[model samples]
Target: MSLRLFNPRVISRAALPSTSRTFIPSIRRLQDSSSDAPANPKLESIVDQIASLNLVEAADLAQLLKTKLNIQDVAMPAVAAAPAASADAAAEAEEDKPKEKTIFSVKLESIDQTAKAKVIKEVKALNPTMNLVEAKKFVESAPQVLKEGLTKEDAEKLQKALEAAGAKIVLE
Candidate 1:
């Protein structure tokens, strides 16, 4: 057994069957099949054109094509039902989410006598279209609404601006 393990005759290369015949035929078949298939230049050009477009441009092109073709969006029945089921679950989870204040009102309660000029300047800065004289009158009128139906961010910004100018302000 030790001699057999060391002998070259135990596993000879000649004993193996040739795989070149089977392997070469499959490769040749693939080449031949590919050569028989026709190349589409129109499709290739369209694909190349689409690939060159940025994401926004591609989306705009898709929208334009959809509109021009008058194609209505068709969703698969299974796909449509899946989102509806998930949306119900999502709606239930949303109930636990904190609601954010969307709309706000910024009211000017009053202005410090010493900072009246500064408050008027700040108000004018806030509304660039309003002249200095109009801004002075707007500031002099106590307990007046500076801006109404503002977004939360806009209201907070206005509140900070008024407070910095030594004016009493409230956001509702």
Candidate 2:
């Protein structure tokens, strides 16, 4: 419950192999704490005493305390196993669920009589390989697929652009 601060004179080189350079003159010096001390003076004393001890002394103290308190070293695998099990269950759930449709087709359903020119221009812009005349012909041929095997996002974008240009379009 309390940390016993070791006296350098009493605890010589033969006592414990402490490579710590921390030095406090006497027990009275620790008892007369500075203004920096927290609400709990006992905690400050324990902290100061622990700070003075080296690695070996601290490890020895921890091991002795663990044994005395009957504390067991629990394996990390027990805690980690839960997430891994849930991940496996999630993978299985995905496998059981229906597969999503990614591929789509953009179809030109119809064109407004007044916006025929605009629709032709949009078609030409969408297809760089096609000439002006060919794009015009492509526009005239309504209810035809503009592009096939496109991703859903690409199909939707194409549909929106054509619809904006006064062409009735549908994504399949």
Candidate 3:
């Protein structure tokens, strides 16, 4: 059966026999590749020349050359191991430290009186147990519609009527 890249499943269902392809490299291919290594003739000659320099000259050159070249730098894998191990050990050590807990308490009281009672009832209906000053403020700030929703003249009459009965009204 023919191979169709997009429909490989159809080929499998067709039950075609499989073929074994063997791969083998010739002698010419084996002889073609060479190892890669750098040959720095200039650096080698400089090292040889430095070794021949007198002690005083070498000391002066060494002082001048601080950090200019590093011949035996440590590999990163070796350098990184110590810090990682120490960090792990530090985390383990910190878990053993004792922790402290804190708690608190509060007390509250309610007061009752007459002129304040009406105000308290209104305030409590809107929001429970409002402070005395807040209740007074609420009464003072209440709207006209809320207070009575009457004309100026009618409001005056109502106020007079309420006063006659020893009552006070606050408008929204």
Candidate 4:
């Protein structure tokens, strides 16, 4: 060993080799250097006691605290740091759910001239309050909605009745 290794004052920055590693402080050193200290004596005492506990005791203390405070054990990072694949899986799960339509609208697309009277009668049957002239005017106006907000079965039935009367009907 050379005396230069022991004498710190003798070693210049340029004299050191380029491949030499930098000095990294240990975790204990960083912990000791922290300026934050609990202002409350009770909190300070609890911290001191917790610091002195063994690993098993510390874990038991955490569980006890969770129960006493009614704090649920949640992995916050899991939600915020979710992967793209997991998000796609969630979207796929939504897509897998059945989404059949329940409501329907019966629309009168067109009325045939030959069965104009029959179409008018059907319209009158559908709306009892409508008079003959009102029913005729309503029938003459092709591409008009006969009824709205009907169930699938009721709309289908209405469509069949109108179609049988020689009127073009549509269910939406």
Candidate whose TM-score is highest: 4
Error of 1 at 164 (Å): 0.8
Evaluate all candidate structures by whole-model CA lDDT and list the values in order: 0.86, 0.85, 0.50, 0.86
lDDT of 2 at 150: 98
Question: Total clashes, candidate 1?
Answer: 0
What shift in Å separates residue 28 of candidate 2 from its native position after superposition?
52
Question: Clashing residue pairs, candidate 4?
Answer: none
**lDDT by residue (tens digit), candidate 1, 1-172:** 3553446446554554578546666888789868857658898799999999999999999899999999888775555648988788889889889888788889999999999999999999988999999999998887888888899888998899889989999987
Ranking by lDDT: 4, 1, 2, 3
* Residue-wise C-alpha lDDT for candidate 2, range 1-172, written one tens digit per residue: 9999987678764465444323334444577665465558788799889999899999988899889999988765445658988788889999999998899989999999899999999999989999999998888988789999999888888888888889999888
Query: What are the runs in model 1 whose C-alpha is more than 4 Å off?
Result: 1-100
Model 4 Cα lDDT, one tens digit per residue, 1-172 = 6553457656665666654323323544577658575367888898899999999999999999999999998865555566887889889998999788899989999988999999999999999999999999988987899999999999999999999999999888
Superposed by TM-score, candidate 2 places the C-alpha of residue 110 at a distance from the truth, in angstroms, of 0.8
Identify the runs in model 4 with alpha carbons over 4 angstroms from their true place. 1-90, 96-98
lDDT of 3 by residue, 97-147 (tens): 764322211111122234445544454444456676766665555432223
lDDT of candidate 4 at residue 120, scale 0 to 100: 97
In terms of lDDT, the poorest run of 10 residues in model 3 is 101-110
